[model samples]
Target: MKLLIYDHDGQLVELEDVSAKTLMLGIRDAGLNLTAQCGGCASCGTCHVYVDNAWQAKLKPPSELEDAMLDVVEERRESSRLSCQIELTKDLDGLTVTLAPGSAFE
Candidate 1:
């Protein structure tokens, strides 16, 4: 499985064999700045990302907690998702997401 992330700088970072790790960790570890203010606790919308529409059906529906958090994000969209709430797995191979403007850690 691979994960593709569009960073704040508009550069794409790719991670191979993405499994177990959450999207937030993968983004940060790839040297991209994503503000996980609550550290993957779903308490903050800082880790928000816009999951590509093509891949929306591949992911599990967001939980109630995640919905509440996303509701507070000004950039919320139909594709919006909390990076911390998505875990990487083989099923998500080729997953791609764009960091929401307001969620950049830097």
Candidate 2:
């Protein structure tokens, strides 16, 4: 349950063995404000974050709905993924993700 968060302020923090919350929830619980406008249904892009290069390939690819939703995200990138769509798991212990500026809830 480790989390590598790239904060909106350009800082990276490594959080270890967090609970099984959705990535968005975990980020919020960790004291970061990430927007989940559509809840965790994968319908909104406000929760978008760019997963680190080394960990991207290890994640499950986005669903077609997620892919479509990502188009609305500001600064969308090849590694962009909706945090709400990401479920915490043991295999994601070292996951690194970059929080897009202006993407999280202000």
Candidate 3:
């Protein structure tokens, strides 16, 4: 349930045991403006984020559809992943991610 947030400002914040929330929901609940324009259905690339290398191996890889959608995101990178696709878990306690610039709901 721990969330390691890489904010728009390039800062890392660790949130502890935040519940079984999706990454996008947790970000919003934490007062961050991560966008989930398609309502967490994995439709849009608005919630695009870059998973830290250290945690990448621990996460489930994005589906083919997700990888396709990520191509449309601005500043897409090798580590890019949609926040909505990331489910919170105890093993992800120290998971780190970076918010893509201009991907916030605002």
**Count of clashes in candidate 2:** 0
lDDT per residue as tens, model 2, 1-106: 6898989888888777689578888887787777777778987678889998998888899999999998887878899999988888778887889888657676
Clashing pairs in 1: none
Question: What is the per-residue lDDT of model 3 for residues 8-59, given as tens digits with 9 covering 90 to 100?
Answer: 8888888776874788888867877687788787898898888989988988
Candidate 2: worst 10 consecutive residues by lDDT? 97-106
Which residue segments of model 2 deviate by more than 4 Å?
none
RMSD of each: 1.3, 1.3, 1.3
Clashing pairs in 2: none
lDDT preference between candidates 1 and 3, better one: 1
How high is the CA lDDT of each candidate model?
0.87, 0.83, 0.83
Model 1 alpha-carbon drift over 4 Å, by segment = none
How many angstroms is residue 29 displaced in model 2 relative to the true structure, after the best TM-score fit?
A: 1.4
